[model samples]
Target: MALLETRDLTKEFGGLRALDRVNIAVERGELVSLIGPNGSGKSTLINTITGMLEPTAGDITYAGTDLVGMKPFEIAQLGVGRSFQTASIFPELTVSENVEVAAFAAEHDSFSVNFFRRRDAYDEVRERTDHILETIELDAKAEETAEALPYGDKRRLEVAIGLATGPDLMFMDEPTAGMSPGETEMTVSLIRELLEDWGMTIFLVEHDMDVIFDVSDRIFTLHEGQVIARGPPEEIRDDPAVREAYLGGEEA
Candidate 1:
């Protein structure tokens, strides 16, 4: 069954149509990659689906619920999560504390009770935070400051923060953006583990064809704000239009 579906999705910024009548679907437990050159609407489609940008026309449905008018937080609460292209976290906070804070805020969004709430009140969040740290292989660094970790570990911490949300489906924008080859390999393995071990579906926006081709079950190609091609990895690798547009006429 389709875990997420978008029908005739369109988004406009004034006179610019960033996404033009695009339709895509992700089945549960599949790792789907969305690839396109810059300005081809990859990020625009992710933003629209994740509620950062409202679509001008069309429908977005997740787990059978329409997400057309939902807020980002609401979508997150509904088991959708995202990690930005850049690593986002508090440098001053400890690694465990970073996930703990996100977990606590996710559980209680209201700020009115902050003054009376006790640290002991967040027992559940604390437990989950530890589990997330372990899952992301950062448990050994739990007491270290976020900024003190190596660059690759910091990236993993950001993934930990997203995992703390307990999402069934995740949108990752360039998860291996600035990693070294070894780090990239580790991250790739981590993403695969999310599918095999955690039973999560992923919709990834990435520039690295090696990473995309290595991990994605299916690939979607976007060009000039429209979905140009989509199919299995081998089919996408052999697509002529994909070569002319994004691949620069080179074979994958």
Candidate 2:
């Protein structure tokens, strides 16, 4: 079975449909990229699959379980987690503390509300936090405030925080957004390392054509709320419709 599958999944708002009859399947251990121009429903699909929004119609199956009505936290507990296009870390917290916060919630029972208790009591959280920091090469900055890190490191920290949740499937929404060429390249290398070393599955939405082309095992292109193309990197690169809509556009 596919690790994550969406069969005719769709969403609508009033008279307009944000996603239309989308059918996508991501295999276990695969690295897939979703690409589209603005308003093409890439983020909408993520929101629907993650329960940030309810879909108008269709099925979402993760690990062969139906996910149509599950809550975001419930989905997280099922070993699926996601990060955003922007750095979504806590600026005031130390880098380690930010990761610990998410790790704590994921490791403990879902109803943990004891804020007065010391966080160190949660050994799993602390251990996972430390492990994720090392994975992202941020252990040296574990004690530093999140806001104090350079821009590139801050972005990586946000992803590390997501990693602390210990998800088998991770969705990264444009992890390389707004970075210099060098920074983008480094982040791409880090993602490849994550796949090679950690055995993690990935779903990504990206705008940098070069990065998506280089890093993706498969690429799906969306246009006007529907899938225009999907294939291996080489096939996607050669697809005429995708080329016309994105790579062959006058601006491109």
Candidate 3:
């Protein structure tokens, strides 16, 4: 079975449909990308699958278990994790603290019970946090405040926070947004490490055509709340429907 599967998933807001009977799957150890123009339901699909929004209809399964009705934390506990389009880090906190918090949340179900404890009290959480920082090349700045870092580093910190959750499948939403060329290259390398070295399965939504084409094993193109095309990168780049809908009828 696929690691994650959505069968005919649909979501609507009043009279309008945000997602219309969408079907997609991600196998283990693959980097699958979802591409679409703004308002094409890319965010909606991620929110629905990750339990941030309830689906209006259809089935979502992760590791063969129904995901509908599960809370966001409930889904996280099942080994799913995500990073946002914008950098979603706690600016005031030190970089290490941010990662420790995520690792702590993943290890303990009840925050009320352990929330007041000293962060150092949890040896495993600290170790995992340290490991993630090293892996993401943020250990050198571990003690710096998140707000003090450069924009690209802030985004990398967000990815590290997601990694601290120990996910088998990760959903990354535009991890390279607002980055310089050099920063984007760094993030791409990190993503490649996550897939190749750590053996992670990723579902990504991104606007950067270069990054998408370079990293994705398969690409799904959405137009007007439905998938218009899906194929390998070369095929997606040349697809007539994708060209018309997303690429301005020009080559990507």
Candidate 1 weakest lDDT stretch, 10 residues: 109-118
Q: In model 2, where do residues sit more than 4 Å from their true spots?
A: 85-88, 109-121, 247-252
Compose the digit string of candidate 3's lDDT tens values, residues 1-252: 999999999999998899999999889999999998888899999999999999999999999999999999899888899974334578899999999987777767645556447566588788888888988899999999999999899999989998988988999989999999999999999999999999999999999999999999999999878999999999999999987886573333
Query: How much is the lDDT of residue 121 in candidate 2?
Result: 57
- TM-score for every candidate vs. truth? 0.91, 0.91, 0.93
Candidate that beats the other on lDDT, 2 or 3, i.e. the better one: 3
What is the lDDT, from 0 to 100, of the residue 35 in candidate 1? 95
Overall lDDT per candidate, in order of appearance: 0.87, 0.85, 0.89
lDDT of 2 by residue, 44-153 (tens): 99899998999999999999999999998899889898874344687899999999877776766454666327565577577778888887888999999989989888
Question: By TM-score, how accurate is candidate 1?
Answer: 0.91
Question: What is the Cα-based lDDT of residue 217 in candidate 3?
Answer: 98
| For model 3, the run of ten residues with the poorest summed lDDT | 109-118
In model 3, which runs have C-alpha deviations exceeding 4 angstroms? 85-88, 110-121, 247-252
Alpha carbon deviation, residue 184, candidate 3 (Å): 0.5
